[model samples]
Target: MHRTQYLNSVNDFIDWFASNLGHASLFAHSYIDRRSNPAAPRTLAFTTLFDACKQYHWKHNGAFGSPAGACLQTNDAALSALRQALQSAINTVNDSKTLTASSAVMSWGGVRAGNVRWLTANSKGLAQTIASVCAALDSDNLSHPVLTSCQPLRFNAGMTKVYSLLVNDFIIYDSRVAAALGWIVVKYCQARKLPAVPRDLAFPWAPAKEAANARLPKNRDPGLGNYHFPRLISGELHAVWNLKAGWILAEVLARASHNPFRNSSTVPALRQLEAALFMVGYDLPLNVSPSGVNSEPESYAEGDWTECYTAARGKLFHYRVEEGGIRLLDGRFYPVAVINRMLIILVELFGTDPFPLANSATKVRVTPSIPGIGYAYFQATDERGNPPSASALAAVLHELGVLNYTPDNRAPWALDFGDYVQRGRIDLEALLKLESERHDDVGELIA
Candidate 1:
């Protein structure tokens, strides 16, 4: 394959593998309500890992696409095999056992944000082995000192399968590895009687710094082997750029709103916009602590909680219902069932029928895919099904039937607020007034 094409394919496969791996673990853990307006934990995890991995890979080599390919192909066998391991781990983590959130470890290390030494020590060696295999795949850096480590070994499968298998393996193993590490840390804590730290359902790796990205660490000591896989136990950003654009869209649509009931295009358009947010890219929160570090937090608001929000700020997500399917901007895709999942979420958040839109009344076909970078589109169509119209959406909702619009059922998503704030009700008008008065960044943008 041409170098550029080869790199693109590799990256694409990586993206797919990352999202799948993260999602598999997350979906197994909890059924999230997207409409609650909370972020997708799995999706955030995927983007975080991808960026970190990309950054790490790029560090040894200058650029990712071409320069990195040379490094990857040299030791293709190791890389390929490792990828397969990661994929297997991802699948196994979800299907093997029942993993509860309370018992989960969100990050393998301590409470500190940059504690990747534990992760790197375990996986960095693997990257080196893979890099050795990939050294011959590219023309540019074949002469580099790193290439000297490259020992050509014959491979069995086609390049694509080999690559896919390797990616899958690494991801699966990555989970196992991290969990193992977490166990070790926990043990150490228990040995000394350290208090247990809480982890999110899906354990997340830390984000990459702007100056240097993170890379997989080499296996430091085989003694850590006991930590790899427990026979089956399983688990598992900022940006205002899109906010400005979305506000612009919302304003444009608001202008078209005619009757007090609804506008011709605005409601669906906003729904589409909401769907697109899932597709947009964002950073994720990660928890990590190095061995020998002080793991306890001296203050309440400083550590992991702070990290979580920082990651939230880095995510710029977008979703839109276009031609019937939900599209995401971050190159990951989901089925229309995912769309309904999202709509159900929003219905709960803003109250059912907050807009003129309704669920589709007929059987539907859903396929979600991202054909290019920076976005994913989901296409939903009726199978002789229902006429594809705004009303059809409502029809489907009616057929499926229950809408989650009650208080007792909505507590998992509730945030603390005074009577003035109104817990369950999302007062958009009041919010707008607050924004207008504050005249902050969001207000300025929306205004």
Candidate 2:
């Protein structure tokens, strides 16, 4: 959180959209490819990237947008459904004296029952917090008066969704959105060639469902100490940060009045940018080097890799088998899955074979923790299972007799899947290219 008093950083943020639209495009393209290449953000026109990212978000984001392709014609349906459902639930419940816990939970299913129970258990606190939010909505000074509950409430992760429904222009400030937004701010500071990132732009990150550096999209660059984001806990701090983000983004949109999204396209809402950030946020740097931070990822031919779950109909994602890893259609080569030994992984669509790092012999990892930076396991998944498998990486190994699993096991994991990863000639070449091309940034002393 160290920083200099760089007051112009906020204006520079707005200016990023106004003058740096092309760079924004590049950032957007590279942002989509972050799962494979986190350290480097690509360059493209902002207008083009804006559209591409929306489609990407629609395609992959677990219905944060849609389950593929923006396609213009079908883009508004899901968002409309989400907004309408929540708006209706909020507007009709007791004519809006306060957002009841019942209506809030009904609007956003992600709210934990325990949090809802807590709100229900204390009516006074919920009413007070709702009033505080309403007051902020009415105020001109977004940052002066802090937004916190009278009670020790820490359900901002869930309640924000409810509040987003009740309040206009608020977004679901989850871990992904927070991480992506922070990364964007860091990039703006870097592009402006600022001496250091000021505290005003330093947004904190919250760990997702898993512990250990889920490596859920962060700055992998070491020298940029002033820019490194701190982990955020969910409570008053989270609410304050969420409000700040909303305010900052609102300013950016308002200031950048004629920025493509406003005039010709049906895409002026704040949610479009939110959806874009959610997609790009899913990635982190695989390798970073001094050759230049924004190296271009290898280009995959149209038919290089088959789309997984094609039988799932409109569920479309195509990938390429290349030197670095299995590159998704959108240029995402994430470390999603593994054979279970290599630091627990993150295979998104297909199973890949890239588990080169060894686990600590002294440590015993709990199954399904998704522990480390690792490889992918590819398998065909025609049907999404109960609790759903990330990729049917195990099914491939099971058929080839490389590993085994049971119906009782939900994830593609086994207790004794062995420590070492074996690779054939092609796989080894790609793994070698992964090392050569990725140019990983580890072991360097921080500046």
Candidate 3:
């Protein structure tokens, strides 16, 4: 009933991990081998796994942490370049000069770092604050704060690269790192037979292309009882979990030190484990159902969108609102006619985001973006302004007669729903009177 002690849980998980080094559940890794077709999911030696990840994520590779990790692609050269740029920015801040006058906004990790606009309010004390946190991490204080300090003192993903230069053993806590960490923690809890993921072990993950890549499933989130792990990772909680992960990983290296590791001395201790997790977290296959049920995509809609949509007129359907999406017995799914995703969400909940069949996750598994921007109003944000948890939502097919996704493997599926949903052409106010009600789980609905 009580919370699990952080160190104790780490110790327990380390021992268990050492014992089950070859377990398929935790380490079933897949990678493309030049010698053969992409390797199938199976048990792999931890060292072999790490090497595969390193090669997969070479420098400048487009893949997120390609091969294994962002850290893996990095070398002394890359670090030095980023570090020099960071120091130049810091030196300007130290001199109390406006950052606009220095190379404070150079790009790193494919994002702008030390943006002058972001630091306008927090420019004061920034150099000292950064120095203070650097001192903590320099002395191996993982709890010095990274995420919460990302914007204030510039500790974002790109900035994390600079901190790694300043600190002895710091891991970059990007979206991939967070996703990989959360996945591992979830596996640890499940293996330990814990009813819920303890607050100590609850590392939050930011939903990204990684979720849709089949590496981290959107459904494999936290929530066992009173404890609920958020799908989105934010600032303070990000720092807390980041440090906890550092602590656990540090101890794991200590416990596993006796075990033989391939290219043992190539990377540092904590980074080795982080890279392996980073590798496994990318493209991780879904756990097979015990009954051998084929894994298939299901609708994201919350309610029974299948019944004759005339009855669906009053029923409310939501997007990931609850366990199976929320449903109100007498409510409307679409109040206003919007475009792109909301239009998709409306059609989705109305049981109309269908194709040749029904209840499929998406026509294409990749995420679709609204064309031409200007729809930021539909975007959701956390209290701490972290990225939205539903960032990687799958695209649903719409029956816009005039518009259709280009018939190709990588179609955008973008559409404008202006006057379409409400104009009775799509029959939005008329309960989809023009469209056929489709459902896979239950029989098709008849009007």
Candidate 4:
């Protein structure tokens, strides 16, 4: 796509998605509301959404499934695992006196898996590089060659993580986003009759021989060597391209926010812009799933049994059977009969009788019972009995609907619960009272 067209498409999609934000039930509206809140910490907001994207991808693409096509035992189960992984990552950097610096290093270290120890060993040097690059980016000094200082840490993915963690100024650079930028830049150059930036610069994994030949020294280009484009030149080019892309995206979103046809109350957040670019880069489906219902089955049975839960009216209504087909309670037939047929085949293929139960001793279990529907529970707990840090706790509370949140037009609740928790606030009796009240409410509904 042309640069203008690409920008327009991304902006248009962001507008459309923003207007229909509530459709993705799993991405609670509170998360979106927090993203636009200036008071919310940027690192926490971005990381939460980033984590959500990973789960969203796994849920939709069957990424957690085994090679034999067996699905995850349950959506909640898979989400729990994802959350645990995130909490483990959070635990690694939770005590940093300077969260932004710690987050940048940890995020960089994460992408460079085998080099984490090395990265950690040279934390001071990595910190310097991150600080310099982030400073240069903020000042729009794309010509400063910031990546040159990042010597051993040359991977674009890690560098992008550093950039993303430092500020909301740059988009994460991956192969897909890189390709989208390349297409835009190439078209822009073509239209203007300017020299095209080399494609090998954008996609560094071009075959070694081809890359070598492309960078061969010429009489007109004496400083150039075979490895110049991939090693040095490409990094410089990427820095320039990233700056341009960021500005273009910001401009597009800014215009969209003010567009007369747009109906969203707030401008798109940087994370939302990144997500829009990601979708455009990967050519992902723009439409949110119909009603945000999880289509995956929770359980299945082989001989004379089947089990599953269907989401309806904001609740997961359960079903089970000891026969040929699922039997919905109260003679509640599936709205889509074809889906039921597909579930039978899925059940036969992936069913493992007696689904695994979560271990209760190690997890904080929250089970809520809906009237006339079955019980649903989720288990999570902080690592090492440590209270979650401010950001981590915010994410958890947001997920649990316990956080102070309001939609676009309303003022957010003013609460110092996070501060109180940090100060070792402990009201065991009050907590017990609250729990008792909650149980009483559930009991009333059940009765």
Poorly placed runs, candidate 2 (over 4 Å): 1-9, 22-25, 28-48, 56-114, 119-131, 142-150, 153-155, 211-226, 263-268, 286-447
The local lDDT score (0 to 100) that residue 360 gets in candidate 4 is: 33
Off by over 4 Å in 3: 1-5, 18-26, 31-48, 61-76, 84-106, 113-125, 136-156, 209-228, 258-265, 286-447
Backbone collision tally, model 2: 22
Across residues 1-447, which tens digit of lDDT does each residue of candidate 4 receive? 233544453453335433333333322211122112446533212232223333221111111231211122332233233334333433353322222233323322222221232233344444454455666677655445554465532434445544654444566554334433333333333434545344422322111111112221101110111111122123555555565566555554454433322332132354444543342233211112235532321111111111222111112233322122223443433222222222232233223221111223323223322111011011112222221112222221222122222222122212223211222332223322332222111110000
Candidate 1 lDDT by residue in tens digits, 351-398? 422232222233222333211100110123223223223232222222
lDDT score, candidate 3, position 269: 54
lDDT of 2 at 117: 30
Name model 1 segments beyond 4 Å from true. 1-131, 134-180, 192-324, 328-447
Using TM-score as the yardstick, the better of models 1 and 3 is 3
What local lDDT score does residue 171 receive in model 4, on the 0 to 100 scale?
Answer: 64
The 0-to-1 C-alpha lDDT of every candidate, in the order given, reads: 0.24, 0.42, 0.39, 0.31
Task: Give residue 42's error in model 4 in angstroms.
Answer: 34
Query: What are the per-residue Cα lDDT tens digits for candidate 3 across 159-208?
Result: 45445555554666655566556666666777677877666666665432
- Residue 417, candidate 1: how far off, in angstroms? 53
**Per-residue lDDT of model 2, residues 88-203, tens digit only:** 54444432323333332322233322343334334444455555565564353444344443655444555666565556556667656775676666677777777665677777
Q: If scored against the real structure, what TM-score would every candidate get?
A: 0.18, 0.48, 0.47, 0.33
Best of the two (1, 2) by TM-score: 2
